[model samples]
Target: MTEPVLCPADPAPVTLIGPPLAPGPLVFLGDHAGALIPRSLGTLGVGEADRRRHIALDIGIGQLGRLLAEHFGATFVSQTYSRLVVDCNRAPFSPGAMPEVSDGTAIPGNTDLAETVRADRVAAIHEPYHQAIADLLAGRRAAGLPTILVALHSFTPVYAGKARPWQAGVIHGGPGSDYGRRVLAGLQGVQDLTVGDNLPYAFDDTDYTIPRHAFPNALQWLEIEIRQDLLGTPDQVAEVARWLAPVLRDAMEG
Candidate 1:
């Protein structure tokens, strides 16, 4: 398998596929899809070894987003820069903001960022991706469809020396609904698949994506995390999309 790139290019990295102004009842986001680092910022003091860590980007999510976009015909917006450059999933004020060190490598560039430089990142990259999201929501609302938010992500198989057994994790914001549960229930018994209602990282009101955007908009939300290895191939992505399509339809109708 080809190694995932550490980051993409600078100045509004990443790509938005499907429609930017679609009125689908669903919206898709891939926060850590980019693997490019900005030239000005450079790689955070982090070394080559650390950049490959889960800290960079959620591996395989780009593929999954493509599959999801095709399967659901939902507008998908994904990040193109490395998460080490700036965690797209994190709140702007959260300490993970511009992490100086990740996965045991000190990100040289991230240490002690100047106020102006930090704001540049927030404005140059972060704001545009989110604006795309806001536009999707606005379009959905305008069409009188109850929007359902689905954030695509992938996790490493092992972290910090501990083995992670979950093949997929389906996370819901604090707000529980049948949408989240029914999807989980549908994926009943795949071999070697251990599913977590919420695993690896949980969500919260203070610092998260689902609730921060979805709830306030009165949208249904489900955050899905596939083990990166499971989604490493195109076949895997297609299989997942095929499997989930009907399940999502059921959830929508339910």
Candidate 2:
């Protein structure tokens, strides 16, 4: 028998903030909101500095998601484990899901992992987080409520020594991303704000959450990425959230 990836004392794989409100069009997701590695993993052979970096999780997204959930009175579903353990946003079969190296940093514990060990992480963390999202969406559908899924994420200002120019990015593609395009256009119109229309990263086969949940339901969805530097402090996060709330609202009504 395999050892459990998460012990009873550990946090749940999924952290749900706010309750689902009927007829509410928003359901937010923070796939890399946390930086927790299971107690069993013991840091995955990563140093403290590296663990605090974007490779471990999406910086400031937890605060941002919570604030957004409060503002919109919508459910925010978030993953609690660090991406280094098992990237919830990547398919379990993808090598990038449990990377041996990320952005030049070596993950010694993940190097040459056994299939069973990998499966344990997938079953423990990846499955439950997504299942919660699916279950919520299903309940909303049964109640005849409309849903507009929004995936929140953050990226490092510089990747592999190259500086990223976009202050924020909106990713939209596939068959069900009409709403995403609208959001993208809306953000682009904002003065003095550099918004990327699928810049930093594009929505593609490598992505898991949005495609898995949104595509099948033909749901309106937007994957938004904010540069980590802009989200460093509490005031900055609040300011960004305040600025973005109207943009999302306008996109929905437009």
Candidate 3:
């Protein structure tokens, strides 16, 4: 049996914001918004430098998601724990969800983890964050409102010692690829940006959030990845948000 990873009074695994019934058709999610390890886990035995790396969180996505949500009055849901603890964007049972190593950095706490320990992280953090997304989407459906799910994320400017040139990526596959394409088209129109169709990474079975909530329901959706270097400052985040908000709005409207 999986032992309970959280004590009786841990903070909620998800942070839900914006009005539940916001007027827009958009719903935002930041699965890698936070980089906090539980007190009990104590940094998962990793160095401070690694803990603060892109493997821990999606860099500026939390603020970007919030700004988009606030701009559109859409519901925003984000995970509250670091992806190093348990990646909320990955399927609970997938290896990436509780990876022993990420982007070349080994996670000491995750090494040779017991099944129960892995299960506990899933139950404690991953499950609740996704459930909150489901609940919000269900409520929107119940209210007879249209929904367009947007999975917000950030990626390292360089990975595995290779420099990636794309400023951003729009990822989607299967029946949902059209919406992603529309978003990509809007982004491409921007001056001096090297946008990619699925550059940084593409969607696959390992992606839990969009596949679970957006794909099955036929909800129009897009999984967007912004370059982490572009989000190093609050002003930069705001600039990206400003640039993206209208593009998304235009895409959805068209």
Query: Which candidate leads the pack in lDDT?
Result: 2
Stretches off by above 4 angstroms in model 2 are: none
In the range 162-195, model 1's lDDT, one tens digit per residue, is 8888788887656644577777776554455588
lDDT of 3 by residue, 1-254 (tens): 53357665667788988997887888899999988887778789899998888999999988998898889988889888899999988888788988999988899989988788888888889998988988898898999999888899999988888999999999978776677788999999998989988888988777888888987898888999999999999999999998898899889867
lDDT of 2 at 129: 93
Better of 1 and 2 by TM-score: 2
Each candidate: how many clashes?
14, 0, 0
Please write out the lDDT profile of model 2 over residues 1-254, one tens digit for every residue: 75688999999999989987545799999999999999889899999999999999999999999999999899999899999999999999689999999988999989999999999999999999999999999999988999999999999999888999999999998877888898888888888999998989998889999889998999999999999998999999998998888899888987
Q: Please list all clashing residue pairs in model 2, or write none if there are none.
A: none
Global Cα lDDT for candidate 3: 0.88
Least well predicted 10-residue stretch by lDDT in candidate 1: 1-10
Model 3, which residues run further than 4 Å from truth?
Answer: 1-4
Model 1, residue 247: displacement in angstroms?
A: 2.6
Report model 2's TM-score to 2 decimal places. 0.98
Winner of 2 and 3 under TM-score: 2
Candidate 1 lDDT (Cα, 0 to 1): 0.73
